[model samples]
Target: MKQKIRDILAKHGGLPTPVDQLADDADLYAAGLSSFASVQVMLGIEDAFDVEFPDNRKSFQSIDAITKAVSGLVGSTEAAE
Candidate 1:
Protein backbone atom coordinates (compact mmCIF):
# COMPACT_ATOMS: atom_id res chain seq x y z
CA MET A 1 0.00 0.00 0.00
CA LYS A 2 2.81 2.32 0.91
CA GLN A 3 4.60 1.46 -2.30
CA LYS A 4 1.54 2.29 -4.34
CA ILE A 5 1.11 5.53 -2.43
CA ARG A 6 4.76 6.30 -3.08
CA ASP A 7 4.18 5.68 -6.75
CA ILE A 8 1.28 8.13 -6.77
CA LEU A 9 3.40 10.70 -4.98
CA ALA A 10 6.26 10.17 -7.39
CA LYS A 11 3.98 10.65 -10.33
CA HIS A 12 2.08 13.68 -9.00
CA GLY A 13 3.93 15.21 -6.06
CA GLY A 14 5.80 17.80 -8.18
CA LEU A 15 8.20 18.56 -5.38
CA PRO A 16 11.61 20.17 -5.88
CA THR A 17 12.98 17.04 -4.29
CA PRO A 18 12.11 13.64 -5.71
CA VAL A 19 9.26 11.85 -3.96
CA ASP A 20 11.56 8.90 -3.31
CA GLN A 21 13.86 11.16 -1.30
CA LEU A 22 11.22 12.64 0.93
CA ALA A 23 10.51 11.04 4.28
CA ASP A 24 7.00 9.70 4.84
CA ASP A 25 6.37 12.45 7.39
CA ALA A 26 8.06 15.17 5.39
CA ASP A 27 6.32 18.52 5.24
CA LEU A 28 5.14 18.40 1.63
CA TYR A 29 4.23 22.10 1.54
CA ALA A 30 7.75 23.01 2.55
CA ALA A 31 9.04 20.67 -0.13
CA GLY A 32 7.12 22.56 -2.85
CA LEU A 33 3.73 20.83 -3.06
CA SER A 34 1.36 23.51 -4.25
CA SER A 35 -2.40 23.44 -3.81
CA PHE A 36 -2.76 22.64 -7.47
CA ALA A 37 -0.37 19.74 -7.16
CA SER A 38 -2.25 18.49 -4.12
CA VAL A 39 -5.43 18.32 -6.17
CA GLN A 40 -3.63 16.40 -8.86
CA VAL A 41 -2.21 14.00 -6.32
CA MET A 42 -5.64 13.53 -4.78
CA LEU A 43 -7.14 12.70 -8.14
CA GLY A 44 -4.32 10.32 -8.91
CA ILE A 45 -4.76 8.55 -5.60
CA GLU A 46 -8.48 8.11 -6.18
CA ASP A 47 -7.91 6.75 -9.64
CA ALA A 48 -5.18 4.40 -8.49
CA PHE A 49 -6.88 3.10 -5.35
CA ASP A 50 -10.55 3.32 -6.29
CA VAL A 51 -11.36 5.34 -3.19
CA GLU A 52 -12.86 8.77 -2.99
CA PHE A 53 -11.30 11.27 -0.64
CA PRO A 54 -13.30 12.96 2.05
CA ASP A 55 -14.54 16.49 1.52
CA ASN A 56 -11.83 17.79 3.87
CA ARG A 57 -8.33 18.56 2.63
CA LYS A 58 -6.27 18.18 5.76
CA SER A 59 -5.46 14.53 5.04
CA PHE A 60 -3.50 15.63 2.00
CA GLN A 61 -0.77 17.01 4.25
CA SER A 62 1.76 14.19 3.66
CA ILE A 63 2.23 10.88 1.95
CA ASP A 64 1.68 9.08 5.23
CA ALA A 65 -1.55 10.89 5.90
CA ILE A 66 -2.79 10.34 2.37
CA THR A 67 -1.92 6.68 2.52
CA LYS A 68 -3.73 6.25 5.82
CA ALA A 69 -6.85 7.95 4.55
CA VAL A 70 -6.83 5.94 1.34
CA SER A 71 -6.31 2.69 3.19
CA GLY A 72 -9.23 3.41 5.43
CA LEU A 73 -11.44 4.26 2.51
CA VAL A 74 -10.42 1.25 0.50
CA GLY A 75 -10.71 -1.02 3.50
CA SER A 76 -14.05 0.27 4.71
CA THR A 77 -16.79 -2.05 5.86
CA GLU A 78 -18.81 -0.89 2.90
CA ALA A 79 -16.22 -2.41 0.60
CA ALA A 80 -16.82 -5.89 -0.74
CA GLU A 81 -15.59 -8.81 1.31
Candidate 2:
Protein backbone atom coordinates (compact mmCIF):
# COMPACT_ATOMS: atom_id res chain seq x y z
CA MET A 1 0.00 0.00 0.00
CA LYS A 2 2.86 2.35 0.77
CA GLN A 3 4.44 1.46 -2.53
CA LYS A 4 1.15 2.24 -4.26
CA ILE A 5 1.09 5.67 -2.65
CA ARG A 6 4.68 6.29 -3.72
CA ASP A 7 3.92 5.18 -7.24
CA ILE A 8 0.93 7.53 -7.39
CA LEU A 9 3.01 10.50 -6.26
CA ALA A 10 5.86 9.59 -8.54
CA LYS A 11 3.56 9.36 -11.51
CA HIS A 12 2.21 12.83 -10.86
CA GLY A 13 5.32 14.83 -9.89
CA GLY A 14 8.23 12.46 -10.06
CA LEU A 15 10.61 12.10 -7.10
CA PRO A 16 9.78 14.59 -4.35
CA THR A 17 13.23 14.83 -2.92
CA PRO A 18 14.22 11.60 -1.12
CA VAL A 19 12.02 11.86 1.94
CA ASP A 20 9.98 9.15 0.29
CA GLN A 21 13.01 7.08 1.14
CA LEU A 22 11.69 7.20 4.69
CA ALA A 23 8.91 5.10 6.20
CA ASP A 24 5.19 5.54 5.57
CA ASP A 25 4.86 7.06 9.03
CA ALA A 26 6.95 10.04 7.91
CA ASP A 27 5.01 13.28 7.52
CA LEU A 28 4.86 13.87 3.78
CA TYR A 29 3.74 17.51 4.03
CA ALA A 30 6.76 18.22 6.19
CA ALA A 31 8.94 16.29 3.79
CA GLY A 32 8.46 18.69 0.86
CA LEU A 33 4.80 18.14 0.00
CA SER A 34 2.87 21.20 -1.14
CA SER A 35 -0.80 22.02 -0.63
CA PHE A 36 -1.64 22.11 -4.35
CA ALA A 37 0.22 18.90 -4.97
CA SER A 38 -1.66 17.30 -2.12
CA VAL A 39 -4.97 17.60 -3.98
CA GLN A 40 -3.53 15.90 -7.03
CA VAL A 41 -2.10 13.20 -4.82
CA MET A 42 -5.46 12.73 -3.18
CA LEU A 43 -7.14 12.33 -6.56
CA GLY A 44 -4.58 9.77 -7.59
CA ILE A 45 -5.19 7.84 -4.40
CA GLU A 46 -8.94 7.79 -4.99
CA ASP A 47 -8.38 6.49 -8.50
CA ALA A 48 -5.92 3.80 -7.44
CA PHE A 49 -7.99 2.51 -4.55
CA ASP A 50 -11.41 2.96 -6.19
CA VAL A 51 -12.56 4.51 -2.94
CA GLU A 52 -14.71 7.60 -2.69
CA PHE A 53 -13.52 10.34 -0.41
CA PRO A 54 -16.20 11.41 2.00
CA ASP A 55 -16.51 15.11 2.71
CA ASN A 56 -16.32 14.30 6.39
CA ARG A 57 -13.02 12.52 5.84
CA LYS A 58 -11.49 15.55 4.13
CA SER A 59 -9.45 15.90 7.31
CA PHE A 60 -7.19 13.27 5.81
CA GLN A 61 -5.00 15.58 3.74
CA SER A 62 -1.65 13.97 4.24
CA ILE A 63 -0.09 10.83 2.82
CA ASP A 64 0.00 9.01 6.13
CA ALA A 65 -3.48 10.14 6.98
CA ILE A 66 -4.79 9.10 3.57
CA THR A 67 -3.25 5.69 4.07
CA LYS A 68 -5.12 5.26 7.32
CA ALA A 69 -8.32 6.52 5.71
CA VAL A 70 -7.98 4.14 2.79
CA SER A 71 -7.24 1.32 5.16
CA GLY A 72 -10.45 2.06 6.99
CA LEU A 73 -12.43 2.06 3.76
CA VAL A 74 -10.90 -1.29 2.78
CA GLY A 75 -11.84 -2.79 6.12
CA SER A 76 -15.36 -1.47 5.85
CA THR A 77 -15.78 -2.73 2.31
CA GLU A 78 -14.50 -6.17 3.23
CA ALA A 79 -16.85 -6.33 6.18
CA ALA A 80 -19.79 -5.41 3.94
CA GLU A 81 -18.85 -8.23 1.57
Candidate 3:
Protein backbone atom coordinates (compact mmCIF):
# COMPACT_ATOMS: atom_id res chain seq x y z
CA MET A 1 0.00 0.00 0.00
CA LYS A 2 2.84 2.35 0.79
CA GLN A 3 4.47 1.60 -2.53
CA LYS A 4 1.19 2.11 -4.33
CA ILE A 5 0.74 5.48 -2.69
CA ARG A 6 4.33 6.34 -3.52
CA ASP A 7 3.74 5.46 -7.13
CA ILE A 8 0.69 7.71 -7.24
CA LEU A 9 2.63 10.55 -5.70
CA ALA A 10 5.49 10.06 -8.09
CA LYS A 11 3.12 10.31 -11.00
CA HIS A 12 0.95 13.19 -9.78
CA GLY A 13 2.40 14.81 -6.67
CA GLY A 14 4.42 17.38 -8.65
CA LEU A 15 7.00 17.45 -5.92
CA PRO A 16 10.57 18.54 -6.63
CA THR A 17 11.95 15.77 -4.43
CA PRO A 18 11.52 12.08 -5.02
CA VAL A 19 8.69 10.45 -3.10
CA ASP A 20 10.93 7.72 -1.73
CA GLN A 21 13.22 10.28 -0.16
CA LEU A 22 10.41 11.65 1.95
CA ALA A 23 9.63 9.82 5.17
CA ASP A 24 6.19 8.33 5.71
CA ASP A 25 5.39 11.04 8.22
CA ALA A 26 6.96 13.86 6.24
CA ASP A 27 4.90 16.90 5.42
CA LEU A 28 4.10 16.60 1.73
CA TYR A 29 3.10 20.24 1.35
CA ALA A 30 6.48 21.34 2.68
CA ALA A 31 8.06 18.93 0.22
CA GLY A 32 6.39 20.84 -2.63
CA LEU A 33 3.06 19.07 -3.02
CA SER A 34 0.65 21.58 -4.50
CA SER A 35 -3.08 21.57 -3.89
CA PHE A 36 -3.83 20.80 -7.52
CA ALA A 37 -1.26 18.04 -7.53
CA SER A 38 -2.76 16.60 -4.37
CA VAL A 39 -6.12 16.32 -6.08
CA GLN A 40 -4.47 14.50 -8.95
CA VAL A 41 -2.72 12.20 -6.55
CA MET A 42 -5.95 11.51 -4.72
CA LEU A 43 -7.67 10.67 -7.95
CA GLY A 44 -4.86 8.37 -8.93
CA ILE A 45 -5.03 6.62 -5.58
CA GLU A 46 -8.78 6.19 -5.80
CA ASP A 47 -8.48 4.73 -9.28
CA ALA A 48 -5.69 2.41 -8.29
CA PHE A 49 -7.39 1.14 -5.14
CA ASP A 50 -10.96 1.41 -6.29
CA VAL A 51 -11.88 3.19 -3.11
CA GLU A 52 -13.43 6.57 -2.52
CA PHE A 53 -12.25 8.88 0.18
CA PRO A 54 -15.09 10.11 2.29
CA ASP A 55 -16.02 13.76 1.77
CA ASN A 56 -15.20 14.62 5.37
CA ARG A 57 -11.86 12.83 5.41
CA LYS A 58 -9.29 15.29 4.17
CA SER A 59 -6.00 14.15 5.72
CA PHE A 60 -3.62 13.44 2.93
CA GLN A 61 -0.72 15.29 4.47
CA SER A 62 1.77 12.42 4.31
CA ILE A 63 2.39 8.90 3.15
CA ASP A 64 1.55 7.44 6.56
CA ALA A 65 -1.69 9.35 6.70
CA ILE A 66 -2.61 8.22 3.21
CA THR A 67 -1.76 4.62 4.02
CA LYS A 68 -3.94 4.74 7.09
CA ALA A 69 -6.83 6.25 5.16
CA VAL A 70 -6.56 3.70 2.41
CA SER A 71 -6.28 0.86 4.87
CA GLY A 72 -9.37 2.12 6.61
CA LEU A 73 -11.31 2.27 3.38
CA VAL A 74 -9.98 -1.12 2.31
CA GLY A 75 -10.59 -2.57 5.77
CA SER A 76 -7.52 -4.77 5.63
CA THR A 77 -3.80 -4.92 5.11
CA GLU A 78 -4.10 -6.36 1.63
CA ALA A 79 -4.81 -3.01 0.05
CA ALA A 80 -2.07 -3.46 -2.52
CA GLU A 81 -3.26 -6.93 -3.43
Best by TM-score: 3
Clashing residue pairs in all predictions, respectively, total 0, 0, 0
lDDT digits (tens) for residues 1-81 of candidate 3: 899899999999989999989999999988998888988988998899899987533568889899988898887857655
For residues 9-73, could you state the per-residue lDDT of candidate 1 as single tens digits? 77887888988888988888888988988888889988987888877677877777876788688
For candidate 2, the TM-score is: 0.68
lDDT against the true structure, per candidate, is 0.80, 0.64, 0.87
Candidate with best lDDT? 3
Please write out the lDDT profile of model 2 over residues 1-81, one tens digit for every residue: 756877787666333666457566666666666666666777887788887777543434445676677778777553232
Which 10 consecutive positions of candidate 3 have the poorest summed lDDT? 53-62
Clashing pairs in 1: none
Q: TM-scores, in order shown?
A: 0.85, 0.68, 0.90
Q: Which rank order by lDDT, best down to worst?
A: 3, 1, 2
**Which residue runs does candidate 1 get wrong by more than 4 Å?**
76-81
